[model samples]
Target: PKEDRERRGVTDGLLRLSVGIEDCDDLIADLRQAIERSARR
Candidate 1:
């Protein structure tokens, strides 16, 4: 994953999750999907 574009609170090896009070299920699903996508290649 790439570093966040907005760098105010970002660190060198940070993995930021921009969840604005969204549903926990959705957030977890999205993370799982992303992890699978990243692991595929």
Candidate 2:
């Protein structure tokens, strides 16, 4: 399962987001917050 997941671009350093049916500004703000949160770690 791990090998198959990696072959399909599901790596540790990869962030894949599938957002749908959400407001544009809200998504942008959420992304900015996530980036800020991760940077603090």
- What RMSD does each model have against the real structure? 5.7, 1.4
Q: Alpha carbon lDDT of residue 2, candidate 2?
A: 79
Poorly placed runs, candidate 1 (over 4 Å): 1-11
TM-score of each: 0.60, 0.69
Q: Model 2 over residues 1-41: C-alpha lDDT tens digits? A: 87898999898788789999899999999999999999999
Best by TM-score: 2
> What are the per-residue Cα lDDT tens digits for candidate 1 across 1-41?
33453355566666866778889999899999999999999
Clashes of each: 0, 0
Using lDDT as the measure, which candidate wins?
2
Local error of candidate 2 at residue 18 (angstroms): 1.4
